[model samples]
Target: MKPIGLDKAEHAHVESSNNATVNSEKLDLSKVKVEPLFEKFVDFDTFTKSDFRIVKVKNCEEVPKSKKLLKFILDDGSDKERVILSGIKDNYSAEELVGKTLLAITNLPPRKMMGIESCGMLLSAICEYDGEEKLNLIMLDSNIPAGAKLY
Candidate 1:
């Protein structure tokens, strides 16, 4: 593939620089599929109504007896700890997620999953890779403090 705004030599340099840390062969996107972008548009006012914030995971554990759920105890800069349940057990283990910073929509109304009240929803990227579904949580930099609002 041709690189935009870069000459052949410059593009080769960039690709070589990344090869030390990234496998260039896996950069191919031909087998990956993503959902179509939303056809409907929302006004800025309506879009800003959703509260997106950075939250630190204080604890994460599999919801007992459930195969797809993971319960998260989060620090959202509030006095009370926030609890959100995400169906990501298949993608990540609780031990691997604790203490990680993540993005979440914190203003959603509470909903019960497995009889537990989930107060918010964590953001994730979902797509089909080589005909198989994949999910990845939206992780944030560790230096970003919890409760920081996203514009």
Candidate 2:
């Protein structure tokens, strides 16, 4: 196979990104505006109120007629299986998430979405790449037991 050179536009795009990162540290941002979601900081007392537990995804499946919903059956150290509806179907496959250990926020009241009751939330990491949003569900190593409290 032959190597391809950047065809004008690609070269300029790469050059701009290189410069952007190099000069980012020197930029002035005292007047910069941020998204509302990132504007506030939660107090420690309020943050500690959330109950975070380690859970294993025993089963995972897509929610019918939904583009961004996935239904997960989690083993959270409880006698019954805990169900959580997540908006991560676009980011992960059912096969990729099954049998994986993850951190879940388990104290929230159940909410009905698409006619299903979700008992908790699965934490995920979000990032931006080339102006596009990317997400990955937070997972832990297998050594951690299910339902272990997160300190």
| Best-matching candidate per lDDT | 1
Candidate 1 structure lDDT: 0.80
TM for every model, in the order presented, reads 0.83, 0.73
Candidate 1 lDDT, tens digit per residue, 1-151?
1111222133222234323211232333565578999999999999999999999999999999998899999999889999999988877889978999999999999999999999999998777766777676887778999999999
Provide the overall lDDT of each model, using Cα atoms, as 2-decimal numbers: 0.80, 0.76
Runs in model 2 with CA error above 4 Å?
A: 1-41
By TM-score, how accurate is candidate 2? Answer: 0.73
- Per-residue accuracy of model 2 over 20-122 as CA lDDT, tens digit each: 2111232122322333477679999999999999999999999999988999999999899999999887777778788889999999999999999999999
Output the number of the TM-score-best candidate.
1
Prediction 1 TM-score vs. true:
0.83
In Å, residue 65's CA in model 1 sits off its true spot by: 1.0
